[model samples]
Target: MLFVNLPVSDLARSTAFYEALGLSKNPQFSDETASCMVLSDTIFVMLLTHAKWRTFTSRPIAPATTSEVMLALSCESRAAVDAMVDAAATFGGTADVNPAQDLGFMFNRHLADPDGHVWEAMWMDMSGGGASA
Candidate 1:
């Protein structure tokens, strides 16, 4: 129900970061000035310059370097999550120091993107969802 647009200093760098996550840019909404990253069939991320991005938001910005929120996405299988994490590493991302924990029905791996944005790649078993953690 919500489409998020993030502000970045460089459009090319931001595009590369999302591409490393296996997402493609929507050319229809993208141009040299901005990039519209396709997150899902309906979800989109419009990466805009700070000046243009402020037009859509009035609140103070959260610096990606110090912010604590790590965008998370669910994967269909454990291997898929691992692959994403591995790809991130291959694209100059850093894997979280801790390995993914297997609580019987859930698996997760965390990695930091090139811009220091943290993302969690996870998979949950529909059977239980691992109530404990």
Candidate 2:
């Protein structure tokens, strides 16, 4: 199972932002300080408040304005990638955080959530997956 944990300033706002991107909340693992967003059957994203996040990490949390990591998600089609970017903007996310790229076999865009966490929406032609990098 894959899990991505992010520190959020506001749990409610962050949860809503992810929901706008089509991930559902998993009530079984949600509470005041944290909420689990199911990305897939085996993938989950845990949004935790800074206070709660500290319990798991000794390092100071990175300010939202300064990105520490970029979360990338693959879409089934170019249109799906576009739609996710649009939804991110509509839900108070900052769009175009990174320049859009189209590589014939791949296309991608970046969106920043309310707390400034970067989420990348990408689409890659599977036929090229086996090609040498």
Candidate 3:
């Protein structure tokens, strides 16, 4: 199972933002300090409040302006990639943080959540056996 733990300034707001992007909150593993957002059967995102996060690590939290990591997810279609980016923007995320990439068989767009975590929504056509440069 994949769990991406993220530090958020506001738990409720971050939970809502992720939900807007189509992930459902898994109440089974959620509490006042953190929320488990399920993206797929094996993919989960744990939104942790700054205070709760400190319990797991003593390192200073990276500010939103810093690019710590870029998380990527595959989409069913090119349209789905566009839709996700649009939804992110409508729900407090910044759209097109990076230039969109279109490699004929693949397409992707980068977006940033309210907390500045970057995500790349991508779609790829694998029937051709390999991706083109």
- Model 1, span 18-131: residue lDDT tens: 898778898998887778988788777777877787887798667756655667788999999889888888877677634677776888988876556677888898875466
Clash pairs detected, candidate 2: none
Q: Write the per-residue lDDT of candidate 2 for residues 19-119, one digit (tens) a residue.
A: 99999999999999999999999999999999999999999988778989998999999999999999999999989899999877888999999888898
Among all candidates shown, the one with the greatest TM-score? 3
TM-score of 3: 0.96
lDDT (C-alpha) at residue 52 in model 1: 80
lDDT of 3 by residue, 27-68 (tens): 999999999999999999999999999999999999999999
Point out where model 3 deviates above 4 Å.
129-133
Go through the candidates in order and give each one's C-alpha lDDT. Answer: 0.77, 0.92, 0.96
Worst 10 residues of 2 by lDDT: 124-133
The model with the greater lDDT, 1 or 2, is 2
